[model samples]
Target: MPRLPDDFDDDTDGFDPDHPLADQPALAAVARFARMLETIPWFSRVGDRLDADDRAAAEDYLSALGFPGAAVVPVGDWYEAADCAEALDMHSLSWEEEEHLRAVAHETALEITDEEALDVALSHVAHQAASLVGPAAVLSMRVGGLDDEALARAAAGYAVQACHQAALVLAAGLGAEHPFALKFRLYERGRWPVSITGESFNLF
Candidate 1:
């Protein structure tokens, strides 16, 4: 796993208190992910492009982390458990989905020690890494003149790897015993986090 930069926790360098997203935990999480990418050596290579070795390394690393396979739960089951009911309503989930999310949230809260830390780590993986790295990989493949098949492979591999990297980065800061690390292992194996104490909600 890569170590975060020494200045990783220094949020005052260019911070603007009045910025709209400054106070938003979700945005802060995303910003942290970006900074990780910018400062970490592994992500520096990833930013250039994900190649065969990168894919292989990701597979080996995730396997070591016990990434058994895709989670048994459907992708939709990993709904965000936000702090506010109003934020939950924004998803427009069906009654069954809403109930299921709440149930999962309740279960997760019982299982984990620090839901907030887990939420931040999940935000880094699902929101920042999956959303950003996958598309970026696809574009990089295109730019490299790879074909559609290669492009698809690169995108999937890099995205999954990026998620693993995000989790590991958090682990570096929060300690390996933290929920961030444990939940990430569960996430990789498909035991998705259903709830967290925050305004940010994960839909996919």
Candidate 2:
């Protein structure tokens, strides 16, 4: 099972808003957005083909959260690697590929946390990163580019960093001390979480 940081107080049953680590601006923004999302039933609209009104409502929510001039677009579908691997004839990333991705993700994580609206930006970047991973892998496997290491590494990095940011955002919205929070901490240490069982995560 995943463990919290040694410094975390074990007595707390859930996220303590008053906790020092919970005082981040990013976390606060995400928490507020999460609450708003719940109120508006945003998650229910996720897979639906968003109509004009749905798009407007989403944009309005984002604008209120300090993202003006941003547009909300619908994705055709959402699937994790495990979900579509067989259909796509996909295999796990090679050891070298994994290393490149992890290294890049760690570096990107450090860079993104410094952004002004990290909570929002990170989520967007995470999606973009996920999109790139498949293409990058396919390209590397089919016709490796000359000196493609940089591109490959970058793709891998963004993918992992996306997972890290997502975990953090989810934890913030759920509660600062939720199991996802532990996942975030695990990512911070360059560890991968394989699964969630009840209140704990299975880490690798």
Q: Pick the candidate with the highest TM-score.
A: 1
Could you tell me the C-alpha RMSD of candidate 2 in Å? Answer: 16.9
Residue runs of model 1 more than 4 Å from their true location after superposition: 1-3, 7-31, 34-113, 116-120, 149-154, 172-204
lDDT of each: 0.38, 0.37
lDDT of 2 by residue, 3-44 (tens): 323222323346576865465544443333233221211112
TM-score of each predicted structure versus truth: 0.33, 0.25
Q: How does residue 52 of candidate 1 score in lDDT?
A: 53
lDDT of 1 by residue, 1-204 (tens): 223232235334565778654544333433555455433221113223334543343334333333434222212210111122223343443224434433453344335334565555555555545554455545544554544554344344534543554444433333343323333333333222332213222212
What stretches of model 2 exceed 4 Å from their correct place? 1-123, 127-174, 196-202
What clash count does candidate 2 reach? 1
- Ten residues in sequence with the least summed lDDT for candidate 1: 73-82
